[model samples]
Target: MTPPITYDGRHLLADLYGCPLLGDAALIERALRDAADRAGATIIGLHLHHFGEGHGVTGVALLAESHMSIHTWPEHGYAAIDIFLCGARHDPDAALQSLSDHLAPTRIVRHLIRRGEAP
Candidate 1:
């Protein structure tokens, strides 16, 4: 019998649609904090920038395990988010769920990828 292989971490790519507050930088930052907490990921730093009124926001949360990034398209009511964590203790799904709760998007699509495989 062979042992199962495990990678160093997980990477989640998520697309959210029909989001109403895509231009809100403060809200997005708060959501990132909530997401990090839900995933049990330690937050090292955070940054967010809003292009202008009726535009969009870009944000990133630097975590001890890895990072989470979010970019929004207000006109399209869409947001693309990435959550990557490098430890077994973190749950990217939980983080995504938290984001969904805060953003209240009508539709969401996401994918999970295993990261850091040795050749």
Candidate 2:
């Protein structure tokens, strides 16, 4: 007998710069949904937060596979994004790529962490 080949997922953390903070929340949310859909993930829920002075954060994207989150610092022109999807057929990379493209960051640092694997 053999152990089942369980599919592990990756958690992506991205540090981005040069992101425009003005009137981009709707666009960002749309892009996130599109990405998740393309990756075969269901968008169960979403939340967006806006700072009083045209700066703030957004998060709470619940996906069937897992979840996606983002925090924005418009004052510093930076944003941090996290995407975690757990499933045998979810493409987290594609979701991240879509976010990067939509944000149009001048510079980006991304880290991928593997989770739920046997040690």
Candidate 3:
């Protein structure tokens, strides 16, 4: 059977404020993984980076559908998250919600956009 046509993908960019997530590398990685699962995206690989003491953490989860990345500023109680997934099987919005729930941010600014159209 022929596969259905795939069009643009969903991309969610979020800014989190007053987050309790304080530069924990492992937690960030886990959050990304959980978000990917919530979005129904397949995780291919994960990479995490830890900065100096009291700096922050950065992590990226490479998914079969697309990718999810996060950077935290614990001192500022802020985090930046990007979740992009291709195809209709996955929902970036769900991932965003899951991440937000995990982080428990007091203020959230979210932007959803469509990326890349069908050829």
**Compared with the true structure, what per-residue lDDT tens digits does model 1 show for residues 1-119?**
85555667899999999999889888999999999999999999998999999999999999999999999998999999999998888999999999999999999999999887654
Best by TM-score: 1
- Per-residue lDDT of model 2, residues 1-119, tens digit only: 86865668889888989887533677768867877887788998888876656776676689878898888887777888888988758887888788877878889899988886766
- What's the TM-score of each model vs. the native? 0.92, 0.86, 0.90
> In model 2, how large is the Cα lDDT of residue 89?
84
Provide C-alpha RMSD values for all models, in order.
3.0, 2.5, 3.5
lDDT of 3 by residue, 1-119 (tens): 85655576989999999988658887787788899999999999999999978889988899999899999999999999999999888999899888888889999999998886544
Stretches of model 2 off by over 4 angstroms after superposition: 1-7
- TM-score, cand. 1 vs. native: 0.92
| lDDT, candidate 1, at 50 | 94
Better of 1 and 2 by lDDT: 1
Q: Candidate 1: where is the Cα deviation over 4 Å? A: 1-6
lDDT: the better of candidates 2 and 3: 3
Q: List the candidates ranked by TM-score, beginning with the highest.
A: 1, 3, 2
